[model samples]
Target: MNDKPPFPGDDPFVDSPLVDSHCHLDFPDFQGDLPGLIERARRAGVTRMVTICTRLRQEPAIRAIAEAHEGVFYAAGTHPMQAAEEPMASVDQLVALSAHPKFVGIGETGLDYHYSADSAALQKESLAIHIEAARRTRLPLIIHSRDADADMADILIREHAAGAFGCVMHCYSSGAELARTALDLGFYLSMSGIAAFPRSAEIRAIFAAAPPDRVLVETDAPFLAPPPHRGKRNEPAFVAHTARVGAEVLGMSPRDFAALTSANFDRLFTKAARTAPSRSGRQE
Candidate 1:
């Protein structure tokens, strides 16, 4: 399962550190090598990373991963694709998990019609529950939508109208309409390595049109590695590549884009920003 490249490129943007707002270091692909993977991320200017827990039952292990690493934080929720299989999550359960100091975000949960259409209803129920937990805890909900733009937008809008909660559309590669809806809702749109693909002009344009402060970047790693490593396993270190493309799309330098996304991450994942020690190991 160790498909990570021998070396993730050199730290070209070391002076301009950024955060990988979404990644899953607790996944089997990173087992036993978490420390090395994190160090690689650090050397490549990824000052912090948020490891996500896609199953509530796995939260203990995922939380342990964050506790063992200095700059790593975690979020927990039942992924939409697993909605039909796992027990529906409750808002109270999620809020209680938020009591942990290292638990910084609410979910990587949302609808996923493309792969699990049969579970759509369950996914929506789970999504609503997560929304309520985020509202209660005042933590950003990390959303994952795929091929369900209209429904996704409707739920987000409906839920937000009920009560305000921060959010980020993690690894966003959906339609421009969904992008617009998310941005209009004061939610952030995160750019992943997919946006760096040569055939992703539309995706790049979607990001380009977004307000600079409303954009974020992620690797979704051990998954979407950006160019120079597109088909290979991804890692937090490679977020620099996606950030480079995001910068180009926004007509800004890589450094500025990194800073912008980091700020957006901090704004959305406020608990992480408040608790994570500054790179210099002191209060900011």
Candidate 2:
């Protein structure tokens, strides 16, 4: 009765459940063998995945993947880098498109000073659009912040002031204040494969200190693959490794980590959806 995004199906990880809240399963890397990859993930206990959007131009493809998979869901928005280059999806477009039966969130948007610190105007403009879309649709917005905590925090604060909305700081690697601010603003901080990196001791501490209910896990697959599989292309199945590390850091068992995080995902991303069954298969 406590599960979330409850869909029509049985879940395999009822006891040790985990959700890869962010990934790009629609990318070309999975095109040739999408079904097979998804099947593999199902056997590995990844029952739900949010195939995030990088550009508004790719929303259709992202939507197709979500529609084809029972447990797979999607978000709609243009990435910070693409917002200027590609045709940006207007707030109306995002709200309308994200209303699809399988779509449950908005964005993969936020500042990325790591890539383009020189263009502050462009990044801020891009982020505001997606934030407004999230507000309009009342969907959790997936954010990708990198090397720009102050601006990111400011924007989130500003947008949140206009109206209350939720968002995830996707693959968080920022300092404690940013995490704290995001938490204060009612945002979820998603941890990725980076947590287990030997060099990320400081970041790992920040992650450990985050409020568990406000934390989420992700593989960010096709990137950030975790330990024992760090060098390989990332996938949803490897979320287990990330979960294991998270459990170790938070002083909980992997199974407990699964249960708690799954509950957390439901609370954050699938608020409108029902709790999925305990026997649900991998949503690659």
Report the lDDT of model 2 for residue 153. 84
For model 2, how does the per-residue alpha-carbon lDDT over 1-284 read when each residue is reduced to its tens digit?
76432221133333465688898998777778888777666666777888988887778888888878778888877778775677756788887887687788888888888877776678788778778888887789888888999988888888899898988898989888989899999788888999888898987898888888888999898898887677888888778778878889999887888888888899887642463633244222
Per-residue lDDT value at 144 in model 1: 95
Query: Model 1: per-residue lDDT, tens digit, 59-136?
Result: 999999888878889999999999998889999999999999889999989999999998888999999999999999
Q: Give the local distance difference test score of model 1.
A: 0.88
Weakest 10 consecutive residues of candidate 2 by summed lDDT: 5-14
Best by TM-score: 1
- For candidate 2, what is the total of clashing residue pairs? 12
Candidate 1 is scored at a TM of 0.95
**Best lDDT goes to which candidate?**
1
In candidate 1, residue 57 scores what lDDT? 96
